[model samples]
Target: MITDPQGTILALFLAFCRMGGCVMMLPGFGSGRLPPQIRLFAAVAISMGVLPVLWDLIYPKASAPGATYIALIFTETLIGIVYGLIARLYTLGMQFAGTILAMSIGFTAPGGHDVVEDATENALTNLLTLTGLLLLFMMDFHHVVLRALVESYAATPVGAVIDSQKMLITLTDTLRASTMIMLRLASPFLIYGLMFNVAIGLVNKLAPQIPIFFISTPFLIMGGLFLMYLSIAALVRQYADGFAPIFTSF
Candidate 1:
C-alpha cells in the first residue's frame, strides 16, 4: 500500500521546510522560551497533517529529486517565514503600545523578565503584553493564522519565484498599520500625560514657593491609573477588533 516511499518522504520534508520556517517566527509558538525540539516536532506534525491535502501540488514537483528540488525547498521556507512575520509584527505592536502606556502613565518600574518572553519589561508592560496575548489566544487567533498559512500554499505554491520587493512592501505596510493601531490604543494615556503635565506646570508658575512637581506625582499616577481602569476594557477590545482587518488585508 505504501508505494513510492522515497517520494512520499521527500514530499513530507518539503512540507516541513515551509511549516518549520513559519513556526520559527510565530508569536507564542516561536518564543525563545519554547524548546527547539518542540518546535521541530510541531512543524513535522503540521507538515504530515497538511501533506495529504497538498499532495497533488507537492508530490509531482517533489518526486523529481534534483537541483531544482533543492531550490523549491528554499523558496517554500521563505514564503512561510514571510507569512509568519506578518503576524509576529502585529503582536509586537501590542508590546510597543504597552511600553508607551507605561511611560505615559508614569508606571516606570524597573524592568523585569517578561511574562511570556525572555526580554526585560516593566510590570505594566508585562501585564499589558500578557493580557493582549491572552485575548488573542481567547479569540483563537492562532487558528486564524494557521488558516492563512494553509491558504498561502495555493497563492505562493511550492516553487514559485518569490518577489523580494513585494515581501518587503507587505512587511512595511504591516508595520505602518500596526504602528497606527498601537498609537490609537495608547492615545488616551498620551493625552492624559500631556494635560496633567501642563496643568502641573501652570500650578507651579502660580505658586513659585510650592514644590508642585513633588506634590503632583501621586495625583498624576492616581489619575492615570483610574483612567486606565475605566478604559482598559475598550482599549483591548479595540486592539482585538483591529487585528482581523489588518491581517486579512495582507
Candidate 2:
C-alpha cells in the first residue's frame, strides 16, 4: 500500500506548489488579516483534496527525474499566480473605486487603519472596500475561484510549459476590465462632484464677499453622504454581479 512513497510525496508537493501559490494572493483568503499559518494549511488541505482527481495528470510528471521536474515547479507556481491574480485584480478594483468615490464626495476624513490592508485609508474608502469584500464573501466568491482552479487542470495540464506572453495578456485584460467596471461604479459621484463644484464656483463669483467655500463644505459632505445612502446598496450589488462574468470568462 505504501509503495513508491517518494513518488506519492512528489506528486503531493507538486499539487501544493500550485494551490499554495494561488492561495498566497487570493483576495479574501490572502488578506493581511489572515495569519500565514492558516493560509498555508488551507492550501495544503486543498492540494490534498485535489491531488486524487489530478493524480493521473500530475503523478507521471512529478515522478520524472532531473531538471524537467525542477522546471515544472517554477511553471506550476507561475500559472497558479496568474490564475490567482485574475481574481485579485478584480477585488482590488473595489478599493480603486472607493478612493475615487471618497475624493469626489469630499469625504476625505483623516486616515484610519484599513480592515483589509495595513495601509491607512479614508473612512468612506474603508467603508466601501470593507462592504464590497464582505459582500463577496457572503456571495461565496472563493467557492467560485476554487471551482475554477479545479477546472484549470484540464485547460493547463501539469508539465506543460508556461507561456509568459499569455499570462501577461491575461493580466492586462483583467486590469482593463476591472478598471472599466470601477470607473463606471464611481462615475456618478464624479459627475455629482463636478456639478456641485461648478455651481459653488459660480456662487463664489456672484457673492464674492461671502466665505462660500467654507459654508458649502457641510452641504457638500451632507449631499454626498445622502446620495451614497440612497445608492450604495445598488452600487455594491452591481459590483458583486460584475465579478461573476469576469471570473467565469477568465
Candidate 3:
C-alpha cells in the first residue's frame, strides 16, 4: 500500500483531502440535497479509488517535509478546485436558463424558492435545474467528469507551475460561454413568451371585458409544459454536445 511507506501515507492523505474537497463541491454530486456525511464518504471513496492508479504519476516526493511540501499541496488543491469549478460553471447554465424562462413567463417569484442554494428557486428554475441534473446523469456526464479529473493530473502536475493567469482566463471564457449557451437554450421560450404576451395584450385592449389574461393562463402553462417536454431530448443533446469541448479546451 502507498500508505505503508513512511511519510507516504501523510502525503497521500493530503492529496486525498484536496481531491475530496473538490469533489465535495463538484456539480452533480455536490449540488444535491444529500447529507454532508454521505457527500464526504463519496469524496473519500472516489479519492481512494483514484489514488492507486494515479499515485505514481502524480504523487509528490514525501521526503523532507517543509514549506515546499505545504506549498505543493496547496497548489494541488487549487488545481482540483479549478477543475471542479469548470463542471460547476457548466451546470449553472441550467440555473441561468431557468431564471430567464421564469422571468419571461411571469413565474418570477421571490418566494425564496426562486434560488437553489439559499432557499429554493422559482418553480420553473427548479424544474430546469432538476431536469438538467437528470440529463447529466442519464447521459453519463459524471463519467466524463471523472475522466477529466484524471486527465487534469496529466495536464497539470503536482508541484508544477500552475498558470493562474491561464486558469483565470479559461474560467472567464467558460463563464461567458455558459451564459451564452443558457441564453440560447431559453431563446425559444423567450420568443414565445414575448410574442404571446404581446398578442394577449392587444386582445385585452381590443376587448376590455374578455378577461383575456385569465383565460390565457391555462393555455400558456399547457403550451409551455408541452414545449418543454417536446424539446427535452434536444436540450439534453445540446448539453451533451457542449460538455465534450470543455475537457479538450482545458
* Candidate of highest TM-score: 2
Scored by lDDT, the top model is 2
Q: How much lDDT does candidate 1 score?
A: 0.87
Model 2, which residues run further than 4 Å from truth? Answer: none
CA lDDT scores, all candidates in order: 0.87, 0.89, 0.74
lDDT, residue 20, candidate 2: 87
Candidate 3 residues 1-250, lDDT tens each? 4445756665566667667757866776775566678878887777778877887754555445778877877787787787778888988888888787766666645645433354666777777777777777787877777787777777786667989899999889889888888888889889978998899999899999998878988777777777778886787678767875874577
Ten-residue region with minimum lDDT total, candidate 1: 124-133
Give candidate 2's error at residue 157 in angstroms.
1.2
Which candidate do you rate higher for TM-score, 1 or 2?
2
Name every residue pair that clashes in candidate 3: 113-120, 113-121, 114-120, 114-121, 114-122, 115-120, 115-121
Higher-scoring candidate on lDDT, 2 or 3: 2
For model 3, how big is the CA root-mean-square deviation? 2.8
TM-score of 2: 0.97
**Candidate 1 wrongly placed segments (more than 4 Å):** none
